[model samples]
Target: MPMTVRSNCTGTLPSVIAGSAYTCSRCAEPHDGPPLGYGTPAPAYWNVEAADQPGSVLGEEQCVIAGSYFFVRARLVIPISDLDAEFDWGVWVSVSEASFERMSALWDKPERVEEPTYFGWLSTALPLYEPTTLNLKTKLHTQPIGDRPLVELEPTDHPLAVEQRTGITSARVQWIAEQILHTNPPMG
Candidate 1:
């Protein structure tokens, strides 16, 4: 499945504000602003075979492959130093069956945030990061009823983790947008 990049702003590039006349390096067109979020439609482990298997399930917020491998879509938030809004990666994490069941049971409840953080492994392979952004240690933090769970990486020297901790600049966000847009064609 193709990854989806979503921008709350109306522009085509990442800029300080919407409708900014920033010329894109890739397309040379004036872009509005950067996308606030990017997401993979399924976990990295998911494939055509997995999708065809019995008992496999894939939904907007959750995934189960062969009734064994469990995944939940969560937000990996990185604060932007120069912007008021933060950047987010809509990534998936692998969790144990027990954790998946507990999360499902409380999926619609307002008190689900009271549950302790669940240990998980990052299952999305993000581009533009060296040493692959796969299998990093993470904690799935349940949010309010309407929000996706937050993915907190285990403190490490990984670039993604470091960015999450210390934040990134608007320039970095723009570079990210450029790389992603240039590489992945817009979906129909």
Candidate 2:
């Protein structure tokens, strides 16, 4: 199939907001609305919360640097039916569009395409690409270690899809983790 860059996606979100209420409907132009901060009108979806965009242009703390692209930094994909119990538990990785493009090229083979996201999905997954690395490292430095960045990855597979398949479609991802662990067991 020809690679068609999706300037659009069905019910897809560009980035994740940390603290803001977002109102979106397929009927609206700006489909995804602005961040309503904490304690505002709740989002419409029962299984979803508002997408939070920090007020600062800065991806982290420094001034907002423009241009390029960066990942919508996430740590984990918690499976949940209700919104309150989901949790992020992994590394936050961001990469420039150029590097992301390169990685996409490397991983786009038919064999690997089924398991993850490729360049095609990168645009939507890591929306705004950054122009510099000074703040990038700073963001990483300030982040806690250990459960820190277990892995930095572009969003490829939809967590929703996985949730649907496992019959583990609830807020307890730890249960899924436990299932995984139990199936494999510790090699003691």
Q: Score each candidate by Cα lDDT.
A: 0.85, 0.27
- Please write out the lDDT profile of model 2 over residues 93-152, one tens digit for every residue: 455566445444544354332333322111112111233211222112112221221122
Task: Give every collision pair in model 1.
Answer: 11-32, 13-33, 13-34, 14-33, 14-34
Error of 2 at 48 (Å): 40
Residue 123, candidate 1: Cα error in Å is 0.6
Best by lDDT: 1
Write down the worst ten-residue block by lDDT for model 2: 37-46
Candidate 1 overall lDDT versus native: 0.85
Give the RMSD in angstroms, all C-alphas superposed, for model 1. Answer: 3.2
| Per-residue lDDT of model 1, residues 128-176, tens digit only | 8898999999999898887888899999999999999999987887788
Candidate 2 yields a Cα-based lDDT of 0.27
